[model samples]
Structures are given as structure tokens and as C-alpha cells.
Target: MNQTVVSYLAQYEFFDSLLALFGGNQGLLTFVIFMIFCLAIVGMCATIGGLGTYAERKISADIQARIGPNRVGPYGILQFLADGVKMMTKEDVMPFSADKFLFYLAPMLALVGVFATLAVLPFSTGFTLSDMNVGIFYLIAISSLVGVSVFLGGYASNSKWSMLGGMRGASQIISYEIPVTISILAITLLAGGMGFGTISAHQRGLPTNWFIFHNPFSFIAFFVYFVGALAETNRAPFDLPEAESELVSGYHTEYTGMRFGFFALAEYIEVFVVCGVGAALFLGGSNLPVDLSFDIIPLQLVEVVIFMTKALLLYYVVIWIRWTFPRLRVDQLMSICWKYLTPIAIFNLVGCAIWVVLFNGKSVAQLLMGGGH
Candidate 1:
């Protein structure tokens, strides 16, 4: 009951703040504040993608004990900026046979679709842009635009390789989305709520209180979701769309200058978003093991840091996987999805249901206490 009230008041205050900003003479202030907030997030993304590009090479190179990107800047740190400027100054190319309107719009659409999903994501308790009752549903609905945007980019390219990449993206996202859904469903069942705040709050005690610990099935579901998420976002071992040797930049083959930059940035940011969502759903989110209520550091800062830590760590994992593993054949990729992930997800869902009926929180807790011999 106490938890219920806190959630209501937090959501009410958030809505009131937004409504008040637009309803009064503070409209201009609201607009500027909103723009700044969005710009901050964008700026952070740019920095991550830019610097992260260099970091990926450096880390991967160090593991192999070879020199990496040393000439571009100190430890090759400035390489990303150089790459940005180079991309910016490059001549824009549009194929004469391409659909010019869509060719130009595709990258922007992809970026928009990818970035827009961040709006509903809660960084920490009482700290999202807006905590809609249907936040999860909103995320799902908005994220599906990635598929449409990929299709548009591919179809507009007027190149067979580009079209093939787009189609592969379409199929890959669709296939992986199933296991992702199943994994997320596991969380919803355990938390008994859909809003991210509620889920985060439900695990307030220790890291062990995370939904990932609610049942054995949920723990497995988390890994299943993480794997599918890699596939869904077209990252690393799953990045067939941009197979450098085969497709020479794939769906955005004709994109140049800043247009290509946007596509590249979107892909990286999407990587961050998916991993962040995973952390929030299964890893106890912003609730640190310590008492958050008493933390001297701002809660928002801690939340963002914890959230980003999870995302970036996952990002590194993706890079490692990319460097270590060869791409699977298209047929093998589909078989892994249908034969392995999908069936396992279905079994996990059923297992969770049975676990809940036979031995939920109380029973499990008792067993841990050595009560039910």
C-alpha cells in the first residue's frame, strides 16, 4: 500500500510538471528545457559512439597484443573525431536510379525510431521522462519502427546488396523479437506489474531481490533475452546487414556525409538502449545494493551511471563476440532462433508458470531458510 502511494504521487508530480510547463507562460522555458534535455542525451550518445569506436579497437587489439590506432591521436583517442569530420566533409552520393525522397529520409527515420524509444525508459525510481502506465507497451510499439525504417533504407538504395541487407534485417529482427518477448514476459509475471518503476522498486532489498532471482526460470529467461536482443538489434555476431566483405555498408550503401553518420550513430545508440533495457528488466535496474535512500550522490546520477554501466558492459560483450566468432550462415541463424531460442523460451514460460504455482516467493524463501525439509 505504501509502495502504491509513492508510485501515484511520483507519477502525478511528473505529469503535473509537464502539464504546468505547457499550460502557462512558461511554455518557452519548457520548450528550451525539453530541447536541452534531449540534446544532452544526444550529445552523450555521440560521445559514446565516437569514443567507443576507438575503445573497441584498442581493447580488441590489446587482447591480441598488437598496436591499434596509435597514429590518429594519443592512444588513438582523437580517431573518432577525425572520422566524424571526414564523414561530414565527404561528398553526399545519391544514385540516379534510387528513390531520392526515401533515400534521404531513411537514415533520419531509422535514427528517429531508434532514439524515440528512450522517452519512456526510467533511469531510476521516479526519474523517467514520463512514466506511463503502459510504458512497456509504448516501448514495444515504438521499437517496431526499426523494422520499417530498415526496410525503407534498403528499398530506397536501388542496389541489390543493400536490399538484401534490409531484408535480412527485417527477418532477423522479427525472429529474435519472439524470444525477447518471452524473456520480458517472465519479468512481468514475477513483478506483477508493467511499469518499470514498480519493477525496480519491487527489488529494493539487495541485488538478490532482483526479479532475476524470483525464480530459476526468470534467470534463464534473462540470458535468453540477452541473446535474442543481440540478434534483434543486429549487433556483433548478428550484424549480417553490414557484412563488410559481402555488402560494403549494406542498407545505407549510398549514404554519405552526415546522413551516414546518423545511421551509424543510431545503430550504436540502439545497442546502448537494448542493453540498458535488459539491465532495467532483469538486473535490478538503478537500485544499488546499498541503501539508495541515503546515498549522498544524486539518485539520478547513480541511476544513470548504474544503468549505463550495464549497457556499456553489454556493449563490450557484443564487441568481443564480434571479434571472436564468425558470422553464422543465414540458414544457421534462423535455425538457432526457431529451433533453439524460441522453443527454450516457450519452455521457460511454462516452467515459470509451474514454479509460481508450486513454489513461489514464500515457499522459495522458506526453503532457503531451511524450513521445508
Candidate 2:
């Protein structure tokens, strides 16, 4: 599997031809190419964000035994377009009492943070925008910007409920990140690297080979990561920051029209990004259930479909959870993170290290089936 995928990427003739134009200035050429890739990713994220809202509404409607959206296009597929038009046409209102600069800057900052994580994602073999060595660490760092933006959005709003929501969101995201980072490190320890492509590349060619089944500790880490990610992204059961019952509209209470749309877009994009990260780290990312030699279509196309299917499955689950679970109280949310999830995540990280040493890097499935390849 490695030889097939890695070899193709290494000898990518198109990329090689592009590199030839740079001659001695390969670094600049790489930077230029990366920027172009980032632009594409931004567009992709925005499109996904719009589609995600439609999916959310439809799924929630089904769960609640309703029709969801059926007005615009077939089965309301064009509802997102209608929503976008509404947002753009609606009044762009800013309270006279609010700080104009921070109010405007907050949504942009949040949007940047979530979308930037896409840069390091390995969409498929040889299809990463920029596979940085410290990719996982880079994702953690960039995502913290969400907290900053939330806080600024709240404080700049000049509304007490907005301020409280912002503060809570900041605290919740920062606290959950501790467990999130540790859980990710558990996978990194197993993969023996921080690059996402490197980590995903280590997954073997079967469902049993996925890291989620690597060991009991890695298994626990998967759930821990899932829970922490829910909190980090302000999903239900941990959505205290935007608790409509208590905080009006939460951090973006004073925002309207396009500014509010930005916040919504960022939130939805973060949902997919977190789920995608979960897929890459725990599932056999972009790997098929059975290894198939590419004959008709390119291997990268097949791999991308597999990867997105896994990611979107998780994304669907997130939506399901949102409609099923009730939001937790702020105190309960904090207690869950600090008193339970963080400690358990730490233990899983340690246990994974010990398991790796004892098993000599073999996954549980490998041990159960026979010995390592």
C-alpha cells in the first residue's frame, strides 16, 4: 500500500514539471503553489459549509419527524442558495454601542482559523495542500483562534449575555483542547510522527488495522477525542456558549446579516473539520476495506471518496447527536472536561505508548489475526 501510494506521489509528473520551472528557487515555487492550494481549499470549505447547514436541517427534521426544507429546489437542495441570498440582502446591523472594529474583525478571524486547518488535511494520497511535519500541532494552534474570536465577538457586542457567552466559549474551547491535543498525541505516538499524511499512511489495508482498534487505550482515545471535539466546536451537550435559552444569541448576539453569516459558516465548517480530523486519525483514512489495485480510475480519486465517506459519516453522527442530546449546563460542561475527560485522555496517551512498546508496533487486529506483516 505504501509503495503504491508513496511512489505515485514521489514521481508525480505534473508536479515534477511545475518544479522544473523553478530551477534553483524551489522554495518560492512551493510557497506559490501552496497559496494557490489554500485558495482552492477556502472555496471548498465555504461550499461545504453551505451544504452542511442543509444537511443539518434535513437530518434534524427527520429526527423530529418533520419535512425539513422542501421549498427552493428538489427536496430543497437549493435552500442554501436562498439562505445565502437572504443573508446578503438582510440588514447588516451593528449596534451603535458596540466596538465597530472588533465586531467586524471577529467573524473574519474565526473563519480564518477553521478554514486554515484544511491546508494540512490529506484529502487523499498525493493530494494534500501542504503536508507540514508539525501538521497536528499546527492545527491545534490555528484552531485556538476560534476561542479568541468568540471572546472578541462577545466583548465587542456590548451585551451582557454576549459577554458571558463569549467567556464561557473561550473557557470551554481552551479546556477541551488539552484533552484533544493529548488524545491526538496518543495517535501520533502510534504513528510515530505528527504529519497527518504520515499518520494516515501508517493505517494498514483493512478495517481491523485502523488505529481506533489498535488497542484498548487507542480505542478509549477515540471516544475521548470525540467528546473533546464536541466541546471544542460547541456542539450540543457542550454548546453553552450559544445556549439560546440563557444567552440570547450568544457571542454573536449583536451581529446581523453577513457578519452573523460568517459566524454560522465558521461554526459549520469547524464541524466538518473536526469530524474529518477524527476520521483521519482514528479510521483508516482514505484506505479501502480491501486493497484494490487502481486500473480504471486513478487511485487518488478512489482514495478521496473513501476518505470523505468516512469523514461525512462522522459528520452525520455529529448532527444526530446535536438533535438527540440536551445541552449541558456550564458547570457540568467544565466538570466533564477537567475532572474526567482530561485525566482519562492522559491515561490513554500513556497506555498507548506502553502498548506500542509491548506489541512492537503491531495493531490489536494484527496480533489477533497472527503476527505483524
Candidate 3:
């Protein structure tokens, strides 16, 4: 059975007391628990997204040798909050020629697509909202909504710049997704399953056990996936979709107030989600360095902390890369994805499969230690 947060909670004795408090309506109790968790996860991600903007500015400032936002609240920690309030209070302006329905729906789609992926993100063994057997596939499929939203937003605006930006975004995202998906498929092959839970489980115990270190091909696959993910999420040097120099903010040129805020927030949160997926897939996820014979709530929380640390470290890298690299030209972007990344990703996938067959699915570390499968 696919374990979920509620199911994991049900294994505890206190859950029985809560069941009685809810008059033994297990269905109702499950619904309430799921709702609470959903709220908590969404709230946490939203906060992370808001803080991402602050991080971006601060990191950029440090890179450029300047002081960033420091006036708001104690080293400008609350700058994101101030920005949020500003966005909320700003006048919402839509182009007179815009398609009313799509202009409104685009941001909603972006937010929904991003938030939906959180359901299967393996924060820990027991904390995932849903540990679906098709978790990885679900995330890949659902997150495409952001690309659709980008196109719709650009088209709905009735501006040449927006239309061009949207087209670039759609094509860039679609092209890059090929290598990303294939790279992930390689990990799925090594894990023998597409579920995030299964993938993470295969990599538990130590850093050497991580899929990235499973083989040379898997290690290469990690970089392939990272590059593809950066493009997919519109991060620099793959941020051609919203290049301010040429497209004047691109797909969101005409968007203002909270509508534009939604797009920004979606992009930031999607970065976090992508980084978390990378950490879970390539790092050891929430797994500790040492194996534990028993699981407890405290240990689970510790695992959550470990998982966050990995994800956030990757987050910092994403920000660092954005500030470090110059944006790629559209041709260079497409060339990298199709000419370079796709071919390399395909090679890695085939190599991983061959390695699995030749070595009886033993990771390099396992084989070195004379461990048998």
C-alpha cells in the first residue's frame, strides 16, 4: 500500500485517541488531517516563495558588492512581507485589449500547477501528502501547466513582446523537458520505480548510497537534470522567457499588481520544488548518514530538517547560478537542450540500464564493498 501522512499517523497510538475524539469517524478524521497538512504545506511553500525574492535581491547585491534591503526589519528579513503588502495594495491593471478570461486564469493555473506537485514531494518517509506509485510522473505532467500558463498569459495580453516571450517560453520549456524527463527516467530505472518514496528509499543510509553516486552515468545524469530543470523553471541563464533587456518582462509585460505577483511567486516556488526533487532524487533525501533501526516522531522531524537542508542548499546554488551566469541567447538555449543535453541524457539513460544489467543492479559503492544484490 502507498503510505501517506494520514496513514503514517494512523500507526501511532495517539491517533486512536484522536479518532475517538472525532467520534470514530475515520473518514472525517482522515479528511481533517489531510486538510491541515495541505494547509501547512501550502503555507510553508508560499512563505518560501516570498522569501525567495528577498534572497534573490540580497544574493545579487552581495555579488555586485552593494548593500541590499536592510531598512525594513532587522537586516531586511521582513522585506518580502513588505513586498507582499505592496503587491496587494498596488493597482491591478489589465491591458484594454487583453482577453479577460485568460488574463485572469493564467496566474491561477501557474499557482495551481506548482502547488499540486507538493502532494507527492517526499519530505520524509511519513510526511508526504500522497506517496502515489506514479509520483514522479504526476509531478512532470502537472508542472507543465506553468508552460501553458506562460503561453496563455502572453497570448491574452495582445502585445507582440508578450506573444514572442510566450512562444520562447513554451518552446524552451518543452524542449528542455525532454532531457529532464529522460534524466529522471534513468534514476527511476536505477530505483526500479517511479515513486519518489521508492527512489529515496533506494538511496538511504549514506551519501555513497545516493543515486548520483550509483554510477558514472547517474552522476552525469544529475548535471543533465539540473540544467534541464533550470531551463524548465525559467532560471538564468535559461530565463529567456522573461528577459527584461529585450522583452520588457516578457510574458508578464502587461501584468500588474497581484496578477504579476502571482507569476513571480509561482516561479520562485517552482524553483524550490525543482531543487527539492533534485535533492531527493540525487542526494540521499531525508535519509540520515547512519541507518536507524526504529522510527519516531522526533526522528521523523529530524529527517524533515535534513531534507530541508539539502533542498535549501540546492536553492542557494540556484540563486548563485542566476547571479553568476549571463543569460543565454534563444538559439544557444535551444542548442544546449537539443544538441547537447538531450543526447547526453539519452546516453546516460542507456548507460544506467546497461550497468544495471551487467552488475545485477548493485550500485558502484555496493559492488566495491563486495555487497551482493
Candidate 4:
């Protein structure tokens, strides 16, 4: 197995040498490092969620032909900070009829499920937190937990609207996962592995080499995956769970203060996670179109920036979509997932497999162009 970034750094004597200066035991040092990494992930996710809110609002305002946050701090960059403080200082109210335990448990569960999938995210060639062999499979399994959390949050709220919203969320997410998995499987077949790193490494640096443009089937599969992902994240068009016009804030209806914030944060963070995975699988993740060998800055950092840029572009699309599209009814959401996306995804998967067998892993673009580039 290839060494992960952390393991690579440790064995190269960087971590050991640094820790030795602190006179810490190996186990202590390991634990401390692990904790720091965990903190970093949490901090990163929370920070993204914070800034993402501002970005989304600004984007929405721009789409509607209005100026966005310009008061909080130059161009309202600090608006999210003010929003965070407001949410923090707000009352943490709970409905008397709510199931206290489950109510409290829901947000944590939602956050945990979303964050846990970060393990398999290959930020760059060697920068993943955990590069498991079953990386994609693990991601599918863990992400399903978000549905359960949504359901619990709604059910525990003891409100009719909340319960209905939770039910919709659970059904929507669970149904969507089917297409998402099959769509990803299309890429897995082409890559011949499930690891995020492996899949990314299979692609070349050029846009033509990206999986979305690899073949007809893969191209179709990318749309299928993208649709499934939007539903999975409870984004617009598929956002019946929190359809304010109907459900009055959905599953987290009764939640207040940080509890409500957790749900919101988890939702936004999941948006990035899905976008990251999409970039890794379909875009030439972290791969520059042309190589630049710079001695001062590592290639890994460059790759990370490239990968994030792709993901961020996708993330911007998600926000754009939320503001542009109207929410689909529950029936429409189900029909699209079960009748359209799932079958298309399955066919795409099978078609991709056949393409791989016939083309011997060469992309259509590569095969047509006589490939030596």
C-alpha cells in the first residue's frame, strides 16, 4: 500500500524529529497529532460553512440584481461572523413536547456523518486524511447516516410539519443514494478501483482526459451523479425537506441556537464534500493542464489548489442552482430519482464497463486521436 501523507511525513523523520524536541512519548505524540488533525477538519468544515453562507447570499443577491453584504466589513466579508455571533447569542430553545435526547442527538449525527466522509477525500496526490481501499464504498455508507439524522431530527421535534419534513428528507436522500452509488460505480469501473486517489490518478491532466468527457456513458453518468448529489445534499429543486412555503423550516423546525446552526453547517459542508468527490471522480482532480516544476513550492500544494478550485467552481454552481431553481414537489422528486436517474445511472454503469472492455481503458478522446499525447 502507498503511504498516506501523514505516514509519509512521519517515516521521513519530520514528525518524530519535531515531537522529540517536546520530549513527548511516541503514543502521546501520535494521540496529540491525531487530535490536532481532527480539530483541523472540524475547524475547516465550520469555517467553510460560515463563509459559504455569506457567499451564497451574495451570489443570490447578484442573481436577483441586488447588491449583497457591503456593510459588515468591506463587501460584507465579515457578515458571516456577525451571523455566527447572532446565532451563538440566540436562545437555545426546545419545545416542551420534543424528545430531548433525540433532538439533541440529531445535529451531532448529521455533522458526524457529513464530516466522516472527509476521510476519503483526496485533496491532492498525497494529502488525504485516510486513503482506504474501499474509499468510495465507505463514503456511501457513512453518508447514508445523514438521512437517519434528518429523520430523527424531524421525528423528535414532535411537530406535524417537522415530522413530514423529516420523512421527506429521509425518503429523498435514501432514494437518491441509489443513483449516486451507481454513477460513482461507473467511474470505479473505468478506474478499476474504488479509492478516490486511484480514480483521480487514472485521469490525465487535460480537460479532455477528465472522466465526464471520457465516453458517452460516463458523460451521462456525470449528470446522473450531479442530480443525485443535489438531492443528497437537500439542495433546491429537491429541497422539499425544508420547503419553507410548506414545512416552515422542515426537520429542524424546533431547533434553536447552535443546534440549528449544526444542521445548517452540516448541510453546507456536505455541499463541498459532494463537490470535492465529484471533482476527484469526473474532473482531473488536482491535476494541472501543464506541469510546472517549482523548487520552492511543492507539487502537492499546487495540486491541492487545483483540486479545490474545481470543487469550488462546482460549489458555486450548487449555490447558483439553489437560487435559480424552484423546489420540486415530493412526487416529482421521487419520480425523477426512481424513474429517471436510477435507471440511467445503472445503464451508464453497464455501458461504461463495456466501453472499458472494448477500449481497454482508453478514453474515446484518446482512442479517436490516436492517443500518444
Candidate 5:
């Protein structure tokens, strides 16, 4: 185990330090640190996701010129928490027609998979819980769970509407996966030569140095990734699976009380995950985009702000698009994947190959300018 992991585990309790010695207690300190890290992350992500929910309602309300949840608590800030408490108190109900086993299991799977994806996100340069060698791969794998969990929830519900939702969700998400992975590959091609750590290091100063601005290829990749991510997360317009008039709440149609709340919460969490991943890949993750003598704001604070602002901006866009656009017909949705995103991502990858081989690790503009002299 890495020394950092060891150190983090040791933070849990001095007594547990002995557990590391038996090859079982590698480092009590590191394990303890990670435990705290996990708790803090889960709590903060939930709260932030909750805040996003509140903001979405408020924003949606304003777009329609209506009051949204204002009476609950000071600008409706308390509404999410109130909803949580109410949900926790509500009875977990299963339709008599549903599969008793899977119905109960589905929501738990969704909640766990969505929340766990946050563990690897780097809020600051060194603030991440686990900087696994496979950070990017881990993100892709864990995030994909959202698609599966939706299938489980919808399939388990035993309603024709729920089954339709599950089937649609699975199809849409699975179709979108190609573009998402391909766009990710574009980023991987541009920067995966550097590990997540090295990539973050590369982005240490000046925003333009960020991969998103590194070249034209990267610029296009971001848009491709964003669109594919929308499909993956089932956001509006791309959200044919849960089309209200069509599917009546989609997969969770038969769920009630806390079970349904868990599903609802998972949707927002997926949005946050997409935003954070985008921030990390194209928006400098936690790096400041400017040249700095001393990083006027410490890297930790800068990382948190840069990453969060990017995430929140992306989150807001998801909301904006949901309200601004109409839902696509199933054929339109599939057409988007096959015709638009896929071709663009593929062409962009070829552009990246040309750019990389010719530039020889130099910035596009610098190479064009012959600025080296």
C-alpha cells in the first residue's frame, strides 16, 4: 500500500494501528484518514447535490415566473433537507405485483453506485481519497453502474410502465456509452500519457494550458463528452427513458417513500458526477488557469473552486437544456448517437492523432508560431 494510504488509515484509532502490523493493518493512520475522507465526501456531495436540487427548482420556477419552494425555509434552501427527512420517515412500499426481492434491492443498488463514484474525485491536488492507478477507468466503470441500476429498478417494479422505462433507459444509456467512451478516449489520447496525477501536475498554472484549450481537438472533445454524458445520465431531451407523459416516472413508478426518494436523489448525484468528471478532464480539475508566482489562492482552495465552478456551470447547463429543449423521439435520440456524436468524436480522435504526432508535445499555437526560438 502507498504511504499515504497507510497514513490515512492510521487516523481511525491508535489501537487499530496494530491491525496494520499483521499484514491486515497496513497502516491504521491512512485507513482512518480515508474513513474520514469517505464520510466527509458522502455528506458534502449529498448536501451539494441537495443544493443543486434546490437551485434547479428555483431556476425552473423563475424561468416560468413562478414561486418555487420558497416558503419551506429561507428561499427554499431547507426544502431538500426537509424532503430528505420526510422521505426517511415515509414507509418503504412495494407494489404487491412487484418482485419482492429485486424491488427492495434496486434502490439500494442505485444509491450506492451513484454515491461511491465521488470517492476518486480530486477536490484538491492532494485532497482525493484514493488516487488509484486506474482513476479514469474507475470513474467510467463506477459511473456506468447508474445505467445498470436503473435497469434493476425499472425491471424489478413489475409495471408495464416501469418495464418500458427500464428498457428505454438501458437502450439509451447503452447506446450513448459508445460516444461517451470515445470522447473520453479523445481526452485519454490528449493527456492520458500523463496519469491523473501527472495531468493535474501538467495543469498546475495558467488556465489555457488546460487540456480543454490545449488544441482544437480537445475543444471539440468536450462538447462531444457533454452530449454523451447527458444521454448516459438521462437528463432532459436525452431523457426519453423517464418521459413523464410516456412512462410515468419511468423506473421508479411503483416505488414509494424512502425507496423512491433514494432513486430521486441518485439522479441528481449522477448529474454532479458528470459535472465533476468534466471539470477534471477539460476544466483543469483543481488547477488555476493562470500563471501565478505563489498560486495567490492556495492550490487546495483553488482546486475546490475551479473544479466546483466548472461542475456547477455544467450542472446549470443540464438544467437549462432540460427546460429549454423538447424531448427527442426515440428515433431522434438514436439518430443523435449514430449520426452526430459518434462521427464527431471519431473525427476528433483522428485530429488529435495528427496534432500529437506533429506538435511533438508542444502547444498548438506555440508550434504554429515557432515561439520556441
Candidate 6:
């Protein structure tokens, strides 16, 4: 059975009192708890999405030798709030010729797709909304909704530039998903399961225990995954879909006010999700550097902190890369996915399979320590 927040909490004595307070209806109590957690996670991610915009500008300004957004609040901390207010108050304009239904549906889909994946994200073992057995696969499948939203947004706009941008986004996202999925498949093989809990469990203890260092092939696969994920999320160098210089804001060219905000928020939140997944898969997740024997609420909070720290560091790297590198041409983007990342990812997957067989799934650290299987 999949563990959930409710189940995790049920183990605690305080939960019994809450259960009694709810008139002993487990189902109702579970539903209420799920709703609370759902709202909490969504609200937290929404805030992160808002801050992502702030971080992007501030970091870019630093790179370009300019001060950014310092007037809104302390160090411009409230800039995102200001931007949110501006977007909310701005007039939402749609093209006269736009397909109104799809134009309206597109932004909702983007936000829905991003928020859906939060259910399985391993924020901490106990805090995850749902620790689905097929967590990673579910995430990959559900998040593809963003691709659909992009295409629909572009097509519905009835603009030539939006159409071109949509095509680029759909094709780029679909193509890059191949290597990214395959690279994750390699890690799944190493960890012997598809669930985030299982994968993270196998990687507990120290940095050396992490799957990325399990073998050379896995190390290479990590980079392949990162590159492919960057493209999949339409980050710089792979942001052909939204190449403002060429396509004038790409698939979302016609969006305005809160509609535009939805697209932008989805993109930023997706980046965070991608970074969090990468951290969970390759960076030992929320595990402390040393293992602890007890499970406690405080320990779980620490795990959350550890997990967020790793994820945010990767987030910083993503922003840095966006500022440092020039965007790739459409042809170059396709070639990188098809000609290079795909082949390398396949090799890594095959190599991981063979390594598991020959070494009985022992990581490099295990072998180095003379711990024979």
C-alpha cells in the first residue's frame, strides 16, 4: 500500500485524539487531512513560483553588473508580490480571432499539470502527499499536460509567431523527454524500484551511497538527465519554444494579465519540480549525511530542510546557466537530443543493467570498502 500523510500521522499518539475528535470516521478524517496538505503544498509551491521570478531578475542583474528590484521591499523581497498585484489588476485581453475555449483552458492546464506532480514529490518521507508506488512514472505522465497546454495556447492564439513557438515547444518537450526518461530509468534500475521512497531509501547514509556515484555510467546519466530536463522545461539554451528574440514570447505571445502569469508561474514551478526530482534521484534526497535510527517529527522537518537546500542549490545552478549561456538554435536543440543525449542515455541504461548483474547492484563505495556481495 502507498504510504500517505495520514498514514504517517496515524502512528503518532496525537492522531488518536484527532481521530476521536472526528467521531472515529477514518475516511472523513483522512479526506480532511489530505485537503489541508494539498492546500499547504500548493500554496507553498505557488509562493516559490512567485519568488522564482524575483530570483531570476536579481541573479540576472548581478551577472550583468546592475542592481535589481531593490525598491519594492527589503532587498526587493516583495517584488514578486508587487508583480503579482500588477498582473492581477491588469486587463486580460484576448485576440478577437482567438479560440476562446482553448485560450482559457490552456493556462489552467499548465497550472494543473504542475500542481498535480506535487502529490508524489518526496518533500520528506512523511510529508509527501502520496508516496505512489509508480511515483516517478506518474510524474512523467502527468507533467506532459504542460506540452499540451503550450500547443493549445499557441494554436488558439491564431498568431503566426505563437503557432511556430507552440510547434517548437511540443517537439522540443517530446524529444527531450526521451533521454530524460531513459536516464531516470537507469537510476530506477540501480535502485531496484520506481517509487521515490524506494529510490531514496537505497541512497541513504552518505554522499558516496548516492546512485550517481554507484558507477561511472550512472554519473554520466545524471548529466544527461540534467541537460534533457533543462530542455524539457524550456530553460535557456533549449528555450527555442519561447525565444523572445525570434518568436516574440513564443507560445504565450497572446496571453495577458493573469493568463500570462499562469504560464510564467507554471514554468518557474516546473523548474523547481525538476530540480527537486534531480536532487531526490541523484543527491541523496532528504537524507542526512549520517543515518539516524529514530523517526520523529523534528527529524522529518530536518529532512525537509535538507531536501530543500539541495533542490535550491540546483535551482541556483539552473538560473546561473540561464544567464551565462546563449540560447540554442532550433536545429542545434534537436540535434543535441536526437544525436547525442539519446544514444548516451541508452548506453547508460544498458550499462546499469549489466553492472547490477555483475556486481549484484553494489555501489562503488561498497566495493571500495571491500564489502563483497
lDDT agreement of model 6 with the native: 0.94
TM-score of 3: 0.99
Specify the poorest-scoring 10-residue window by lDDT in model 5: 1-10
lDDT: which is higher, 3 or 4? 3
Name the regions of candidate 6 deviating beyond 4 angstroms: 371-373
Clashing pairs in 3: none
Model 5 TM-score? 0.90
Report how far off residue 302 is in candidate 4 (Å).
1.4
- Poorest lDDT segment (10 consecutive residues) of candidate 3: 364-373
lDDT-superior candidate, 4 or 6: 6
Q: Which residue pairs in candidate 1 collide?
A: none
Estimated TM-score for each candidate: 0.88, 0.92, 0.99, 0.94, 0.90, 0.99
Per-model C-alpha lDDT, please? 0.77, 0.87, 0.94, 0.87, 0.79, 0.94
Q: Give the per-residue lDDT of model 2 (tens digit) for 1-373.
A: 3222223444656657666787847676667766665777688778889999999999999999999999999999999999999999999898989999999999999998998888777777566776778888899999999999999999999999999999999999999999999999999999999988788778848788899988999999999999999999998978899999998889988889989999999999999899889999999887767666653337667878888898899999999999999989878898999999999999999899999889888888788778554
The window of 10 residues in a row where model 2 has the poorest summed lDDT is 1-10
Following a full C-alpha superposition, what root-mean-square deviation does model 3 have from the true structure?
A: 1.0
Q: How accurate is candidate 3 locally (lDDT)?
A: 0.94
When superposed on Cα atoms, how far off is each prediction in RMSD? 3.9, 3.2, 1.0, 2.2, 3.8, 0.8
lDDT of 5 by residue, 1-373 (tens): 3223334334546536467555565455446567877888898888887787798898899888899998787887899888888888888777888888888888888888887788677776656776665777777887777778889888888899899999899889888988888877777777754245655666556666777888988899999999999889899888887899988888888888888877788888888988888888887887766655643225556667778888889899999888889999999999999999999999988888888788775666556568653
Q: What is candidate 3's lDDT per residue for 84-202, written digit by digit as tens?
A: 99999999998999999999999999999999999999898889999999999999999999999999999999999999999999999899999999999999999999888899889
Regions more than 4 Å wrong, model 1: 1-33, 292-297, 361-367, 370-373
lDDT of 6 at 142: 99
Summarize candidate 6's per-residue lDDT along 1-373 as a digit string, tens digits. 6989999999999999999999999999999999999999899999999999999999999999999999998999999999999999999999999999999999999999999999999999899899888999999999999999999999999999999999999999999999999999999999888899999999999899998898999999999999999999999978989998999999999999999999999999999999999999999998888888889999999999999999999999999999999999888888999999999999999999999999989989999897675
